[model samples]
Target chain A: MSLLAVGTLAYDDVYTPYGEVKMIEAGSCTYIAMAATYFVQPVQVVSVIGGDYNDDFLADLQRRGSDLEGVEVIPEGKSFYWAGRYHDDMMGRDTLDTQLNVLADFDPKVPESYRKAPYVMLGNLTPAVQSRVLDQLTERPKLVALDTMNFWMDHALEDLMAVLKRIDVLIINDEEARQLSGELSLLKAAAKIVEMGPKILIIKKGEHGALLFEGENLFSAPALLLPKVVDPTGAGDTFAGGLIGYLAATDDLSFANLKRAVIYGSAMASFVVEDFGTRRMQTLDQEQIDRRVQRFGELMTVSL
Target chain B: MSLLAVGTLAYDDVYTPYGEVKMIEAGSCTYIAMAATYFVQPVQVVSVIGGDYNDDFLADLQRRGSDLEGVEVIPEGKSFYWAGRYHDDMMGRDTLDTQLNVLADFDPKVPESYRKAPYVMLGNLTPAVQSRVLDQLTERPKLVALDTMNFWMDHALEDLMAVLKRIDVLIINDEEARQLSGELSLLKAAAKIVEMGPKILIIKKGEHGALLFEGENLFSAPALLLPKVVDPTGAGDTFAGGLIGYLAATDDLSFANLKRAVIYGSAMASFVVEDFGTRRMQTLDQEQIDRRVQRFGELMTVSL
Candidate 1:
């Protein structure tokens, strides 16, 4: 089965202690599509960008097995651009620039071929935009996983919850989980969110790892224990890519499968933080992916 | 085949949002011995107390299969006393009182029966006291695990490093590890500590979990993902008890065995946080232990 991801495909400027790199290729849809391409045969990406968005960048995504037919090009506007500097901890960041450009008034249109895709990933974006993509889907996808940030939770909470009820899984960072549920305890927050809609809740704790809670069963996947994290800009998106990619490839959404998916996501996220922006993910290959997955298995295993 | 734990046994007054309990039984040695007794047949405890130390308390430790022959009673002084208040997170606490009483000028004397024990747990205490206990051992234990706090690291860096060189395993919290090694990254800190002396290094991350680093192999054991934590006073000591206890019970110090030991320690720590002080460990039985172990296995497993 194929997977379709809906979000921004944009250019980013990232600053880290390692150094500063300008005009780095980034965005939720870009990383998610790249990561998912490893597990699935073909991944479809739907988003809008301006003429300034380079052809080479689009070609790279195509090279990674992503179908770019759904990616719309706006000749007048510029691609979404964001600039941020990560602190030493890599856990916190300060946004230096955000020019929505084409994303300001863009609309997402799921291509006809992608309409039949079995899985859908809603990356972090405006609630209105996310809802628009969902509205365009002819049939409900077998599984819908959504990733959102604090912005949507604060500004578009009602729309966010509306989308939450329609999705099968809701993935968010720990702080957002606490804010959405109005509960300080993550467990309590997850339980409350599950009651609101989604059957599964994945709480991402950044460097600490992620948790998969379905019913009474809870599984934790630790982030790759790196000595130093160069940049953490898109680690969360990379994790989401791994999560939905594994599920789409296996066509299995069982709790056990979801646990493995989280591990894959964590392994992919580890690479994302190894270098600034998408530098590491760009150079990552199947061999490196397998080795990191094995490392995650060994790191997490409990021998009897 | 057996383990000996040396430290204080005292009454603790603790307050938490869940509730408050005055004069609850608590002490690093007491919790450590109790946790160790779960896996090992009998844990020998060595320490001193005053006339005020209750017989019923001593009986409680003995009932858990701890040998109290090494406990010395001081005729005139009072027992050690501690009071603390847990914040909302439960991961940090404020020391409200610390009356050393008989512990002020204590000199631990390892009993003849305990001198030949194969495993020894040096719970948090003065570096000099830890060194004295090491000096008293007739034959070097197969494994010596030392647990220390930031207090000693700040006050007695030389003595602490001296004792660290003589131990087989060193366990300290994440902050202390950073301070001792002057490295912000845990991976770097662990590597630095291994160079200093111990072959095995454990960096505790409180609720997040703990990391065990030996040479190139690293194993992470997550803390029990509980919805609520009543108290966290003795959780670290209980964790140490479980680690050394599991090691002594298995009589294996290989990396594979260390993985299981960390899981056991994590499970024991989970129990400690469920209630105030050592209350939960006190009521825990073999069946509960088995079930928690099974849960941990399931939580970390991935069929890759």
Candidate 2:
């Protein structure tokens, strides 16, 4: 089954205690495409890039089995740019600048071939944009997973809620889950979220791990606890890609399958944070991915 | 194999958004004894109470197979008392009052029966007191686990180090691990701690779960992830009780056994915070514990 991901393709400048990397290729859609390409072939990416986007970066994605036919290039505008610096612990960071040059008027148009993709991932973006993608779909995909942030919930909750009702699963951080559900406890927040829409609710706890709740089935996937965390930027999006990618490749969305997918996502995310932007992810291969997933299985499993 | 626990037995006045539980039965040793009693019978508790300690509370301990003959009742002093209020989220709290009273000069005397117990748990307390218990041991216990707080590390570094050298395992929270190791990364902190003395180090990330590191094995256990957390007080001590108690009951100190014990501890601690101090744990039975452990096994297990 093919997968279609809609988000941004932008430039990011990231700073960590280890040092800084300038003009790093980044964005939610780009991250998803890169991570998913490891498990699934020809991930169709629908995003807008600007004239300034590095051709080499685009070529890299093509080499990794990411189809760029759906990515629109706005020749007159500048690429979206974001700059952030991680704190000492590297779990949290402060955004330095957000230049939404090309992204300011982003109107993602899914190509004809991409619309019928069996799996869809709507990365964090304006609710209107996410809804636009849903509107373009001829039929609901086998699975529609979404990633959203607190910003949209705070400012565009009604639109976000409308988009949420159309998705099969919603992936959000702990704080976003709490804010959306008006619940303090994550478990309560997940239950409330599942009632609102999606059959599955994933609460991402960053360094703590992620929780997947569907009805009464609850599964936890611990973040690969690394001794050094260089950057946390795009880790969440990478996780989403790995999750959906694994599920798409296996053509299984059962609770058990989703649990393993979360582990795979976690493994992919662990590589994303090892270096700035997507440098580490760019070099990761299937062997390394499987090894990390095995490590995650080992770190969390115990026989009675 | 009996388990000997040394710590405080006191009353706590806790207020939370859920409600207030006044004069709730608390204390590290008390919580530990109750949790440990689930897996190991006849847990030996050594600590000082006072004339004010309730008779019914003591009777309840005896009924639960807690050998309290080592409890010294001071006629002139009062039982230790602590008052605290949890914030809305229940993850952090502030101490309102701490009246050492009888615990001001507590000199725990290890009973002759407990002196040779195979398993010994030194609950969080003054490092000097912890050392005294270690000194009283007639023969080295098969396993010695120590729990200490930031207070002792801040005020009694030498004494804390003295005790660290004698313990087989050290149980501490994430913050304490970072503070003690001076490393922001938990993995690095655990590594640094293991070098200090303890062959095993368990970093408790309350509500998030616990991590166990011994030799090359690393095991992570998820917290119960309850829908509601009425109170978080005594959760850590309860977790320690569960961990050591399970190990003592099985008399297995292998790395695999320790991993299972950590899960049991995580399960037991989940009950500790379901309501105010010892309330949930008090009502928990072996069947409930078994069910929770089984769920934990399900939540964490992944076939490779």
Specify the poorest-scoring 10-residue window by lDDT in model 2 chain A.
A84-93
The C-alpha stretches of model 1 lying farther than 4 A from their native spots are none
Question: Comparing chain B with the reference, what is the TM-score for each candidate?
Answer: 0.98, 0.98
Model 2, which residues run further than 4 Å from truth?
none
How do all models score by TM-score?
0.96, 0.98
User: Across residues A1-304, which tens digit of lDDT does each residue of candidate 2 receive?
Assistant: 8999999998999888899989988999989999999999889998998899999989999999999998889999999999998888776789999999989999888898888889999999998899999899887899999999999988999999899889999999998998999988887888889887899988899999999998989888887779888888899999999999999999998888999999999999999988888889878888998898899988987887
Q: What tens-digit string does per-residue lDDT give for candidate 2 at B193-288?
A: 998899999999987888999988998888777878888888899999999999999998998899999999999988888888887877898899
- TM-scores of chain A, one for each prediction: 0.97, 0.98
Candidate 2 TM-score, C-alpha based: 0.98
Query: On residues B270-289, what C-alpha lDDT tens digit does candidate 1 reach at each position?
Result: 89888877878878898998
Please tell me how candidate 1 rates in CAPRI terms: medium
C-alpha lDDT (0 to 100) for residue A277 of candidate 1 = 78
Model 1 per-residue lDDT at A242: 87
